[model samples]
Target: MKQDIDIPKVEGVYVAIVNEYNDIYKTQDWNAYIINDNDDALEMVIIVTDGYSEDKITSKFRKKIDVLPKKSYAKIELMQEELFAVNNQFKVTYFKGNTMYDKVYTFRKNTINLKALQPVPLMEARGVLVK
Candidate 1:
């Protein structure tokens, strides 16, 4: 049986904290925010919370510090946008080293769940990391 779902036309920033998959390299999770979405391109900012060399140390010892996130923009040509009416899933694709990948970002019950599809390396190395 086919079911229909309502996909909202959302415009604004969506934030999420994605953890590293156990199958791949076990590293610290990062935060990703969808800053803008349009027909031309999608702008996003990714923040590495921990597990990376650069994120491990702090400027002031025993003190709290704030770090800026990296900005990335993916063009329409390099991505495939899909809206699933069945589950209200919104996905975007990008390529890395000739391999394509998709990341699904969906809103449910006022919460956003974003997942990076298989071939995680490409997504971290190219898709969200690409400037």
Candidate 2:
């Protein structure tokens, strides 16, 4: 059935991030349709490896620019409308509001994305509803 085939294309993806405490954090179900809605939210997150984590990254949330995806060659890019220093933060954001072909959107469009998912410590990652 045509409908059945189309259903597989509309699924969401998962991406991951690590907080200042070396704890991981995962994003919500990033639906393809929904990814287009938010601009202020972080589009790209930095993958802090064990090798580079000590220098560019800090144990305390030290204004680090999260990485997601990036252009092949660029020094500075706009993310959440903020001018983030490329030196401190290795992540990169899109430059256009209407167009979404940059590295930021590529990771978002993937059917199974890893950039959006955050892997945090189970004890610390648990949620507490305020309502």
Candidate 3:
């Protein structure tokens, strides 16, 4: 029964968009990252990301990470400036110990700008985070 199913609340994991300088390109770039702030390692992490709006939709990007250790972060992708006009989403799934956990993180249209950036947990840089 639906009421009998055990769905644990997801915590300590977050998706953030950070603005930083690129050494090779010599320009500031917008990038997405997955932060794991838990004490235990996450296994078989999968992320499906995309951006969309009523009139425009970006391509779907699927990323997989075999393992993400505690208190670490990984760069997911470099986001172009144009993509920020639409709503961006990251669907995340992973296993902690024997339990499976999942969550959807979304950045609303025009909300990924520098003005919205804040100190991201477990990361040194500041950026916008899905609340």
Candidate 4:
């Protein structure tokens, strides 16, 4: 029965941690985003995020999006500067058509700094993207 179960692979979806200027706050801040690079739309998307290290752990949070349009992205949350020293993890689950798929994206400790930014797909700003 295990072999008969078709667990579809998740593709073209990613989580990015971006450092951008916040107009309202008048400072640069790190933010998390969910990018849907697939041609098909995703429904009932959920993302659970947290940060942890050997001696410290941040609070866990969940975000739900009813629909993520094809080739689009949504802001999930803001990343505290101190959390960058710990491992940040994001578990993303969503439905494509009638099938379900999920994936976990992680940013290793001290790996989310500005020097590691790259051009993110479907987004004008650059950030650290995990595929």
Better candidate by lDDT, 3 or 4 = 4
The candidate that wins on lDDT is: 4
For residues 1-131, write the lDDT of model 1, one tens digit per residue: 22553333434323232333334656443333332323333323222221112223212111111221223322221111221112222343332223333444543321212343222221352123211
TM-score against truth, every candidate: 0.22, 0.15, 0.94, 0.94
Which is better, 2 or 4, measured by TM-score? 4
* Candidate 4, run of 10 with poorest lDDT: 1-10
lDDT for residue 128 in candidate 3, whole number 0-100: 92
How would you encode candidate 3's per-residue C-alpha lDDT over 1-131 as one tens digit per residue? 97986758889999999999999989999999999999999999999999999999889999999999999999999999999999999999999999999899999899989889899998889999874
Off by over 4 Å in 3: 1-5
Q: Which one wins by TM-score: 1 or 3?
A: 3
Question: How does candidate 3 fare on TM-score?
Answer: 0.94
Clashes of each: 0, 18, 0, 0
lDDT of 3 at 40: 93
Superposed by TM-score, candidate 3 places the C-alpha of residue 34 at a distance from the truth, in angstroms, of 0.3
Candidate 2's residue-wise lDDT over 1-131, tens digit each?
A: 75643222111222222212222444242211112122233343322211122234322121223332322211122121111111222222232323322222222112122333343322233211110
User: For model 3, what is the error of residue 77's alpha carbon versus the real structure, in angstroms, after optimal superposition?
Assistant: 0.5
Order candidates by lDDT, high to low: 4, 3, 1, 2
lDDT: the better of candidates 2 and 4: 4
Candidate 3 residue pairs in backbone clash: none
Ranking by TM-score: 4, 3, 1, 2
